[model samples]
Target: MKKLSVSILYAILSVAPIAGAQGDIAAQVVPQVLSRSPEEIRPWRAPVFADQSAALGYNESAFSIPKGMEKQVQFWIDVYTKYTTEQGVIHDAENVETVYEIVDLKGLKTEREKQKKVDEVKKIIAARLSTPEEGERLRFQLGQKDRMQDAIFYSGRYLEDMEKIFRDSKVPVELTRLAFVESSFNIMARSKVGASGIWQIMPYTARPYKMISPVVDKRNHPLEATKLAAKLLRQNYSMLESWPLAVTGYNHGPTGVLKMTKSYETRELGELIQNVRSRKSFGFASRNFYASFLAALEVEKNANKYYGSVVWSKPLPAQDLKLPVSVKYKEIVSWFDGDDSKAQVYNPHLTHKARKGHPIPAQTVISVPKDKYNVALISLARKDRTVAMEDKKGR
Candidate 1:
């Protein structure tokens, strides 16, 4: 297969100097020809590969990757399965398929040293880009490799529950695999930007779903978060009318994606991603979001092929108990012989205030071990009656 030329490579170099650069230049460049019509922007041609055996599997599923996006999805599959944290790939940010090289940084001691090596590679790529006859190369440095293997291992803990949530909500069950791309099924994961849980939902986005609160941010709870994520995804699909755009909206705001669709005059996600001029809001991450998701789905669907025999974490066994009245966290822990750790493990959504003896709001449904549900219910009932009696006496 012939490599696609980086026609706009020089546009990227015209920006800022490469000194101590940490971000991709391709992402920074705003092409001068943003006025070009959608038809003027060449459509993506599926890359021809020598081995048909390595081609992506096709299914009539709702989440199937578009033909134009196969190369991008395949690139992400390599990032997830072929690469590890110790390595990084230098490639075109716009055209994910055009790879400059993959540099191994195992021996690099510090982040500064690793970045310096990456910058050196970028300089070479720049030179190559300047001289188009040298070869096909462009700009971008992606180092964060997917922990898909770990994600697959942990997904067993919540995949069944997530499927039920989406199914009950009438959303596509396969969208549950999005956890792999969002947070790698790391239940405790929280982003610097305040997106939390396996879904990586922002506080603002989760607010409408009632997932965020002072007493509990349900976004940290895998099952609860999955329900909200399902609703949010459905909302996105309703607005965009495309699974690819809806998934992209999960990363980039739906409004932004809608704006891009209008600006580019195309609803085809492949066309929007391929032709949309670079900007601050919809950049590399947004463009590749769906591709990464499709990659995750493929890798997870064929886990045994990518990762051999795997031991998946067992789903937690628990029963949901709704609190009759506001109760303290420690009191709930007392029901299980003061096993704070066990209590926390089951109800991971409790806030700091709840932990510090502040009352958990009434009607809050908490999970407790199935075996201990009866005893916990008894204790909760007794506590509720006592509170009621105190209120009656005060009245």
Candidate 2:
């Protein structure tokens, strides 16, 4: 009995110690039940307690915040300052109220400054563009009574067409009368210095617009040249953006108009006219364009009272055509000039009675009686296409 008791005691001692060791190991593996709160468990990276609690939930220890990053951390607080109701929530932080007030004041100031800039831009654009007074002055120029009877009589033909051109361009209808003072509506009108056509297009200026070709200076063709003239006027209007400058430029070229613009400084059309210093440069003709337009208006207002409407009513319409010019001048003259007459209606600049020494230039689009000669002239034009190319130097 004693031996059995001794064996049992040995087993109990050995197994009991082993069991105790296992219990000790289990106690070490179990997580510790700490008394510290979630916020207290981790150092605050953010000032907010919620952020610290999130850190604690993740079982983190001391937070590894970046050095010298206090401002960065406070920035989030500043952004969400309204949400923070706790007293002393952002001690030593930016004064959010002051910052927001300053920002609002700055926005107001910026808007005022922006409005000022917008007003300035509007003033600049207004000065550059058209104005009512300018329109009135131009009207006066068209309504002038100088060269009264003859001016109106001669201009009657082209004035009708110019009216249509100006109307299409939205330029005042009265300004069309300047064609009388410029070219007398005669397509063949040439200045002593060689400016030609109704618009008085100078050779140098007309060359660039392709108004003058080797065989033909289309500046003499009223419809063709007027189309080019309108294009040039539109371009000038874009730059100076004034009808006055545009009209002056039509007479004096763009460079001349630009000089006037610079001399005046301000782009006001009235100022430009008022400050006119030269009679030769931006002088008499340019100055008189407005006067001429005014005169034209007066004539138009009382067309029948001054000059009968018959001549004005019968003014030729502007026609646009890609004329097939192939017939030699001799052939064209034979077809158009009845009874072997040498007179050519189209190019008045051409030497009369064209002979072998002065061979008739081909492809010449003679603006004859529109309906009467169109078919016959067209058939003759197809005969000498090569001759048109041969005499390219005369023009």
Candidate 3:
């Protein structure tokens, strides 16, 4: 609609810059803004579109414009905006301005062009995998701030275990980097749809893998979750025959991705991304899955130059700890008072919400600091022997 153009014109002119070198800013700004990776652009773009659409009462459905209707709709809006009402119509400038605000749709072409550019860049980057070096650099760039930095460290730690799982299972090594985008490697990563963990496992899907529980969800246990993630990925890879689709399947689930494949009649991941609705069919998190992964890869690839060296932990040491007749939670805390902080790190499987009646099951596998392995083993043995003697006496 012409009014859309008028609105955009107002936006451009309002901030358009005043004369000379100042006006050059807007021209320069366009590419600079466009150049930001889609991840960087999305937070800025989503709200802008939401507000504009809200003002227009244009509810953006999963399918906004039907395949061919975009052009036809724009043409009609273009025609509608060019003419003004005459018979018994109001003449005040305010009235004209009000009508124009409500109806002018001139920038359909420019808006479409901007959207196309965004869609194009996302498609190009989504299918490609960054080299390991590129991944490291992109990791650092993603880690420039505290939030993403924590995500990077946590995710990197998870990846080490995930890589081991992949190697041991003989899965492709490229799949290891999938977590880089999944949650930037954050174990606590949760999507808008409530998908949780480094791999963004939804509760329903995680349940079958024995990851979800009122007492302890395995999804929070990184190593366990990674194993599950590998299993799911391997399964999907078998059928999808493409790493990108396999990755997409991780977000969409096997059934969801398969359905999209049937509907679109294409297995191309790049093509799937261009059709925004298809991406959303999997869930909100998956909609931008490839974009974030690519951004993280680019950042991790250049990490050292951007943010210096990152500490990659050796795989968290796994150990076994047997409780004495299922001790109370607070009692266990009291025992580790001096090193209480180590409890959660070593025992991520333990339910954090357990209270008086709820308690962690005995004999759970725990991850401990490598240095504490000797002490933990010796202590548990002594306790186990004591329990055995007490049980014999009772019998």
RMSD of each: 13.7, 44.2, 20.3
Instruction: Please rank every candidate by TM-score, starting with the best.
Output: 1, 3, 2
- Identify the runs in model 3 with alpha carbons over 4 angstroms from their true place: 1-146, 155-158, 189-194, 276-284, 305-325, 331-335, 354-357
- lDDT string for model 2 (1-395, tens) is 00000000001011110111111211111111111222212111111112223221122322222233233323322322222111111111111121211011123233345334433433444354366443222110011122233334445445556656655665444445556545445444555466666666678877777555444667766666666666666677666656556655766676777876786676544455545364335543454344334334444455555444323213432222234543344554454344222122234333323422344444455544444366664565554455466667556
By lDDT, the best candidate is 1
Give stretches of model 1 more than 4 Å off: 1-61, 105-146, 276-281, 335-342
Question: TM-scores, in order shown?
Answer: 0.76, 0.49, 0.55
Candidate 3 RMSD to the correct structure: 20.3
C-alpha RMSD in Å of predicted model 1 compared with the true structure: 13.7
Report the lDDT tens digits of candidate 1 across residue range 126-204: 7757566332334444433335565665576678767767666767766888887776665656554576777877888
Q: Per-residue error at 20 for model 3, in Å?
A: 41
lDDT of 1 at 30: 20
lDDT of 3 at 392: 100
Q: lDDT scores for all predictions?
A: 0.67, 0.41, 0.45
